[model samples]
Target: MSDSGLPDGFADLDPFVADWALPTRAQRYEARLSKPYDDLVSFYDAVAPRAEEAIAYLNGLDINDLPDDAEKLLQLLYSMILVSYAVNVFKQNRIPDSGAAFFDMVAEPAV
Candidate 1:
């Protein structure tokens, strides 16, 4: 844990992402494409639930008042929160029958 007592899981994400071979966006996307269900479940298990604490810790801070580097780190931590939400709460893996693939934003609103 850091001096602030945050979980090492929250304090450092690089090791976690690297451990899963998903340290980069492209690698994560590939994991989703190649192992959609496994990747989502794995990521959720590793990062979610635990991420709530991290999110809460970050939320408790005054982001706007933080130093530039600290703010950037906080932003990255928030990204982890978002990813956990998507994978765990949303359970987004593949389209109903479209096979395994990464989520693509809808180009336009569904009519």
Candidate 2:
């Protein structure tokens, strides 16, 4: 097990530890990338198609099905980690909300 660089209270985020420790820009430029990082990138690419499937699965859930504690996972999947990778790395700006209340908490979108 690696030191996650996170505090103890945020245990639910442990699953994301491997993805989070990916090489920085300098490291990638220097070709000091680890095999695990490359594997993770490949894994995410392989699973890219499943994002929509996951979204559809989420849509299938009823309000009652989601326990109140799901907020942490929601934020982890949305605001914290994913947007950076989607927008910056994958070059996608528009996030598909699929007529859901996706941007409710966000401010106005810039033109």
Would you list the C-alpha lDDT of every candidate in the order shown? 0.49, 0.39
lDDT of 2 by residue, 5-96 (tens): 43334454556544432333332222212334354454345334444544455466564465333332332334323334543464443334
Q: Let me know the TM-score candidate 1 reaches against the reference structure.
A: 0.43
Residue-level lDDT of model 1, residues 3-97, one tens digit each, is 33333445544444332433244444445545456655665565555656656666766755754333434444443544554465556743445
Q: Output the lDDT of residue 5, model 2.
A: 40
Return the clash pairs for model 2, or none.
Answer: none
The TM-score values for the models, in the order shown, are 0.43, 0.31
Top candidate, metric lDDT: 1
RMSD of 1: 7.3
